[model samples]
Target: MDGQLMAFTGVAAGMVAMPGADFAVVVRNALDTRKAGVATAFGVAGGLLVHTALAVAGLAAVLVAVPVVFETVQLLGGAYLLYLGAGALIAVARHRSAATAPSAGARGEVPGPRPTVRLGTAQYLRQGFFTNALNPKAPVLFLSLLPQFVPAGQPALPRTLLLATIVVGMAAVWFPAVALLVDRLGVWLRRPRVSRALEATTGVLLTALGGVLLAELVLT
Candidate 1:
């Protein structure tokens, strides 16, 4: 059991450290606010729980067996990424417009209100959850990876749950740490030019990722 657990932890840690859509979303949210970053992290963990449930319930096998279902999930996930990317780009445009426009106050000298960042807690959570949940690769990950660690005589479901729990815990730790680090840099990153650049970069990356996923679906 100890050996199995150690292996599981190593694998989970590696996965958590890998830069992917989840990491991108967390970094983007962290630039907005620490709370947004944390919320996104927890939401991603929640999505993992859903994946774990599906894997344990044997639904992951069904997905793998059905090509259409798998492709549909891929398409949906890709579309969501495109949606997020477009929204980010739009935000960049709005911020640029606001920066260039002077406010007309009573004295004609008051500063304009800062653009309200729309990343509320629920939005953060939903973005994270959908980003993680919609990816067909997540289910495939668990389905392929968990069985390798199951002890020969042990029940698969319980063992899979235990391993999945380890992954969830690892994500909970790693993402919050990322949020804190990014938050520390918020002072510089929040500058209008820097923020716009970051936003644009994130938007481009997400859109490109979405395109790649959709291309794979089409080619396969």
Candidate 2:
């Protein structure tokens, strides 16, 4: 393995490990079910592949140079994040209210489990894909950051694909691990209070991140 490739791998790993939208999406879905979590990870991998393809084809660089395009994407991304966060927060509120409100119960009648709106695999996949794909940061990062690691005197296209693929490979491994790890904690997470807390926190994190992203784009 080339020394430069090793360094790139390290940096790419760090980037993938960062707690961004992808991380949020994985954790959010993982809380629901392991299948949801794994599907989300796969979707995130798909999103990364899209970015790599764009970077390899020089579309990433082109988008970077075109500020309007990047800005538009960022706005949409921010809006989407805000929507996700808002939805989660709303769910939390509804859950809390439902918990607190007293309903007439028959004497000695057992209560059934509250109905949950389980999102299908396709929905989870799309959620995960959009969470990562909308950011526009990938193209920018690939354009600026990937080149620094590409070895000189090598075919740039192939080298770019190789490095980009490494990032994708890392993402593929890391996110599913994250999903599974969170799934392991399902025992405690199954508790309503704990679940609601997790939901609320993630909701705020996503909302704030989206607001900040949008604010930055608008203010700058």
**Among all candidates shown, the one with the greatest TM-score:** 2
Q: List residue ranges in candidate 2 displaced over 4 A.
A: 104-115
Top-scoring candidate (lDDT): 2
1-220: candidate 1 lDDT, tens digit per residue: 5898898889889988898888888888888789998899888888888887888888999999999999999999999998888878888888777666655343465343335466679989999899989988999999998899998999988888888888888888888888888889888877778878888888888888888899999998
Over 1-220, each residue of candidate 2 has an lDDT whose tens digit, in order, gives: 9899988889999999999778988998898899999999989999998898888888887788888998998999899999999998998888777665556242443333332568999999999898889877788888788789877888898898898889999999999999999989988875778888888888999999899889999997
TM for candidate 2 is 0.93
Q: TM-scores, in order shown? A: 0.89, 0.93
Candidate 1 RMSD to the correct structure: 3.0
- Clashing residue pairs for model 2: none
